[model samples]
Target: MAGVFGLAEGEVKTGLRRAARLVLDTLYPPHCLACDAAVLEPGTLCGACWVGAAFQTGLSCDKCAAPLPGDPAEAPVLCDDCLRVARPWSHGRAALLYGGTGRQLVLALKYGDRHDIACPAGRWLARQAAPLCRADTLVLPVPLHRARLFHRRYNQSALLALALARELDRPALPDLLLRTRRTGIQDGLSRAARFENQQGAIAPRPRRARRIEGRHVLLVDDVMTSGATLAAAAEACFAAGADDVDVIVLARVLREE
Candidate 1:
């Protein structure tokens, strides 16, 4: 009798939740992730917003995913910037170039408290990151310092990572990495300074260190500027005994743009 009652009760609760969600959606239809214009789906851009985004579909650098000027059929090669710097990760990709609609979406997700943006952004990232995945891959986000995380009430990168994990049907260990120290804001910092500031900021959590060994670590982030933060995070994965490392970002700052 107890088992039968428990099963019926569970069904009732599930039905109630579904009904509540349906009512809520009807009362407040989903809006565009970028502009708040009504969209057919919850995590989509409206037509105007879609048209303005600069998706990186052309041939790009395998090291950084920065767009190159060769044929689309051409294989990806290293960008001049990637060649000039030591990127700790083996490969990287970004869904959008950081400008226009792309910048708006990134800023919204990062600072505007618009977490719904993570849905579409994560879908885009999952698509871009498919090529980087390996059979032994584990997904992790570049972490936040505890103080900053407390103030923000959330880590935007972690949100994106969770969403990507769902889309890709992969496990996301959001707490795998810890920001060892607070590297203050990167605004106006020279490229070298940004790299220096992020030099030792990230590492695998002590308890989670064992899971990283012999794994291909794929680091997720909201944006890549000088590739400094990603570089630091990749280094941490290596130190944690990761077999290989790759990176993906929602947007990347293309030099020409």
Candidate 2:
């Protein structure tokens, strides 16, 4: 019968697609981003890599997400660095401490063309940032200068922001924040120097300023070191009449040494 033949054809097509997928997977099995060892799933690390990653949990600083030393009962403590410096954002969270596997993952994503890492990393960030997400929250990434954007071809922060936005069901506006000027690398810079370098580096786009007005804006970045860059970005959002600004990073540089 005609109906029977159509069902058989549909089954054959499904079988062909499954066979193709199996062949492709065999040729290029998913591998760990950090160690290059084959993993059971994509966007995941191997067992050894997971063991090395220092994920931030438990009691932490309310402002910067720094790991607190004392008993869990004494929470909401501000770290020494936060106490001395006034951060622009109200709250911040980081998925991993910037060392060991976390450092390796960040390097791979930023330089090694490993964009797949964003999915897993963003999912983790989404969980960490959930407390800040709201119906009117606008999610965005730290913008890159035009020159650097051209050279890199893609902004890794934007990739993570996009993924995080999807997970949180928030509106992602990549162009909301603009890097008005380029600054030198912040590597090995003192805290004060980093703050000075980022001065006037970022601003909200004039045409898109209204989008940020009166809304909770969440800024995403690959890593946070001195908190200077994030502070600068949050300042811009606040200047544009944003109700509040929060930050979420894939990793946080807990120590320089």
Candidate 3:
């Protein structure tokens, strides 16, 4: 239905959208994602922020996405932490190492109510998570306890999971896992204490059990510290009759070297 100046309706709509964006950008101006520095694009980091981000590129651990110094051609690598610990999930990937600009972005999205960060972080996650996905895989987030959800108003991990699912064109069940117990914050806890705290804390809902049965699952979360939280979530998936599970997170926290 061409109406104006021999242009198609779709073209007209696109032109209008571009015009609106141009006006808005001119007024507001784009800023760096991690910092407030001006950037040419909306969802980009500045030159300094880019250098400080520590995005994972090559030679990463297969079980968890920690950086390793080795040949890029190597296959099926494991980091020291993953090797020492028993991981219930089959595989894992992360978009960034949790420090510098990456850590700031995570904290912003998690506690500062900066939901806009999810859009860019999700794209970064999707790139790392793609190779781990399967046709039958069901993507879902590590659930937050009801109390925590009420206080925070939104679950940042669920937002990232939904964004990743959209990018991959896969099915996502956001409420598949339930945090039955309200465990306190895991920050500053030792490795063993963290695992003990998360133990048996999450489980699948009985009514929703059918949705998880026999499905291959991909668990998503914002960050992986001790990995105790993910392990607990994966264990819940298995309890719900999942065939197997893998994990992906926006960032992976590394122990001091």
Candidate 4:
């Protein structure tokens, strides 16, 4: 069953690229993403950075994914904030705690075009989102209005969604969710202002509405500050006949009180 140039089962197949790989490994092997220290292998971060990484832990609020201050084993561990004001989406999950290294990494991926960083971060998001009951998931990133899209040249939410979908082995539905109206910048807005500004700011594409029906949609965004934008998008998805809607974000900024 062997071909004319058949080689043995354990034979060394030589090539110029293999030789180049050897040279490359010796000169510049893989390094940690957080720090420049050499790592034992590719796709791994240094021990110190990995240990220091602020991973999301403990039971989170059922609605907002904010960590609750109680034993995780207890059911109904909703945070006080969630009890006060219900979120639009069923629930949400985030891979890392906001601020510190997590915040810096997100900024780098967003503005620096360091897309390679997505691999590690996206993998973490996929793991965090696995507990949801619905497996037939469709990922939808919060869209930037056309005007902002043109100015930014790309949407950070869309990039995060794409990376997340790939990690979760789900289809990312970017075009299905559309932001037809341009809203004011949310950075400096108060919580009330953020909600008011984002009102009527997002709508599902008419033609694409049929495709989302009866599906579990996961909305992805880079950050959740006031949670207004996510709420608006979830409302639109529900209006379009989506069976359920959940959200996943890179970070959730705790309100300054």
How badly does each model clash, as a count of residue pairs?
A: 0, 0, 0, 0
On lDDT, the candidate that comes out on top is: 3
Model 4 per-residue lDDT at 7: 53
Report the lDDT tens digits of candidate 2 across residue range 72-140. 578668899899889899998999999999999999899888898899998899989998898899998
Comparison by lDDT, 2 against 4, better one: 2
lDDT of 3 at 86: 82
Q: Tens digits of per-residue lDDT for model 4 on 1-257?
A: 43335854334344555777778778889877766889886555788777766777777777777776777687446678778887888888877767776776678777777666777777788887877636678989999888877877788888788888898788888778888777877888778888899987888999888878999999988877778999999999999888999998887676632
Maximum-TM-score candidate = 3
Q: Which stretches of candidate 3 lie over 4 Å from their true place?
A: 1-3
Question: 1 or 4: which has the higher lDDT?
Answer: 1
Q: Candidate 1's residue-wise lDDT over 1-257, tens digit each?
A: 22345667677778788888778779999888788699776778899988989888888888888989998677768888888887889888989999989999989888889888888788899888887777788889999999999998888999999998888877899999999999999878888899899998988899989999999988999988888899999999999899999999999897521
Off by over 4 Å in 2: 1-23, 71-73
Residue 130 accuracy (lDDT) in model 3: 90
RMSD over all Cα atoms, model 3: 1.7
lDDT of each: 0.88, 0.89, 0.90, 0.79
In terms of TM-score, how similar is model 1 to the real structure? 0.89
**RMSD for each model, in Å, please?**
3.5, 3.5, 1.7, 3.6
Worst 10 contiguous positions by lDDT, candidate 3: 248-257
